[model samples]
Target: MTPQQFLQQKLQSRQYAGSYRKLQVQNNLIDFCSNDYLGFARSLELSEMINAELQNYPTILNGSTGSRLLAGNTIYAEDLEKLIAGFHDAQACLLFNSGYDANLGLLSSLPQRGDTVIHDELAHASIIDGIRLSHAKRHSFLHNNLHNLEQKLKAAHGNCYVVVESVYSMDGDFAPLTAIAQLVKQYNAVLIVDEAHALGVFNKGLVNQLQLQSAVFARIITFGKALGCHGAVVVGSNDLRQYLINFARSFIYTTAAPIHQLASIKMGYHLLAQSQLIIDELQIKIELYKSLMGDVPQSSKSSGAVQTLIIGGNQPTKHLASNLQQAGFDVRPILSPTVAEGTERLRICLHAHNSTEEITQLTNVIKINLHVK
Candidate 1:
């Protein structure tokens, strides 16, 4: 059968249930939906800066024509890597097309067959997919449960890698970094932290701020979320960087990200360094989201830049989202099988550009609609 026919047959139940997702192109809504955490994507200040940087190379190629191993390698890409490495205090850095590819490449290639990878159960899908692609014996600990993570660690004796996100994407929560670092240290295991949601936010992630670089084997910091650009970087030792350059198939096989995209990433990095306004705005919005969510049953569970309300069912979650949208809030439903069946939620993303008024109004809309639904 054709792809369309196959999808129609296999996924029709989802479509009929109001859970099938097609891209909804709407603008001008009070956005609590996108991962543009710091609102740099819509920042004209950064846009003008990027345009100015382009002036230095007027004929800068539009796209990177090939993979980094081939003709895609460029001076600016290497420069960006150095800047990233220095910013995060890593010995080196390697760029990937996106956070997903970076995780896939790192997890699939880095861990040896005899190694073990213990990860958090609630990790993002990219991390889970990457671990599946790995050859290591894998185990999962309960979300944010240090004791559970330690129990798994104590039972393992191998070249282990503890995988976690600095800031979890869905729940907007932070990893127990200090405790995890201590456990990994006791086990003599390498720690891999995906700082995808923390980059250009959280003072450049817990790894950088808490001085966990010496304890961490690698960090995956992506530009998509807070930097509001595209692409990701794996930051670690020069050897790890070189190894990925040689063995990471995602980097090896794919066309390199375009020069303009790299330029944008570079520009985004510098903009993050120069400005604290976006960071401040986001903190304000986060506070607003928290304040608005007051007296809600699970309000204390909020973390990172995402505020998730676990509504427990796909149909109701989608209904609540639709209601919020109708009420002028652009919130999205996180449904199964994206999350497990009962953990379905409204994934509200707070942004630097989101005003206190917008946050308060939207969250109130969410509470009213979700409670009713």
Candidate 2:
């Protein structure tokens, strides 16, 4: 067989072996699988704000014509950064195209050569990829294990950067930030927290709510998930922000986020403040879901908004998610390659708009469809 044919044949085997992936759009189901945590994405209030901003800025162009350094540095990006900085109580902020780009830009550029980056073993792909792009030494500790991380930190390493996510995306678990921050202080290392999954859900990310900023080096905030908009912001010292503008290749090379997107983020923040309905509703749903799910089995450490069911294979995870969809819930599987071989799962995403009845329905549907009983 030709080389290409051989490759495709092996790829087919990968699927049969339970790790292949293909996207499917499942419609007509109650959502248990979207990142629209705060219901802001569908809010008429946010859309109207965007419309109003565009109307006011008559001469402002649609696209950020070039990278931020070139032509993309619009007035809106600058203002939005300032707004975020003030809101999050940080000295300065740098906006990236998205959470992925933000992670790529910062993790790839900072923690220079001779520096050590000790990250959570279960950190999102973006975090790992960003570290891969860096010239620093990288290591991963057991997920949320402070002692494990402490041991690694004690081993050979130069100036260390302790990295973790506020709300882990895959398992929906949280890092022990206070302990991690204290350890970071003892080690005299820099602490960086990624608040990607925690932003609007926990309010301004875990770092802000817990008052961990003074102990950490930087906090990564993504507007896409909780803010329910586009783009991300890195909040830290002014020098760090300036350094990213100068050295982060992702920021230097990519086109700046469009003006409307930035405006939408700004609008979303205001909406979050004006009415706590969406966030409160989400908390209620979360509490209800957790109560019904019965302590999350301790075995399932990752059961936040992004819960992992750990059903054991791509086909099983996919099959279970499909069955749930048929039962009127939009659950999606995190297939093998995305996770470890035996840890594929139905990555359920809980939303603020998800009603109590919907939550109960999904829970019943999932357990039954997966034949857990």
How much lDDT does candidate 1 score? 0.85
Each prediction's TM-score versus the true structure: 0.95, 0.94
Candidate 2 stretches greater than 4 Å from native: 1-3, 6-10, 295-303, 370-373
Candidate 2 matches the true fold with a TM-score of: 0.94
Stretches > 4 Å off in candidate 1:
1-6, 16-18, 300-303, 370-373
**Backbone clash count, each prediction separately:** 3, 2
Model 2, 167-218: lDDT tens digits are: 8788898988999999988888889999888878877677888888788889
Residue 244, model 2, lDDT? 95
Clashing pairs in 2: 171-302, 172-304
User: Model 1, poorest ten-residue lDDT window?
Assistant: 364-373
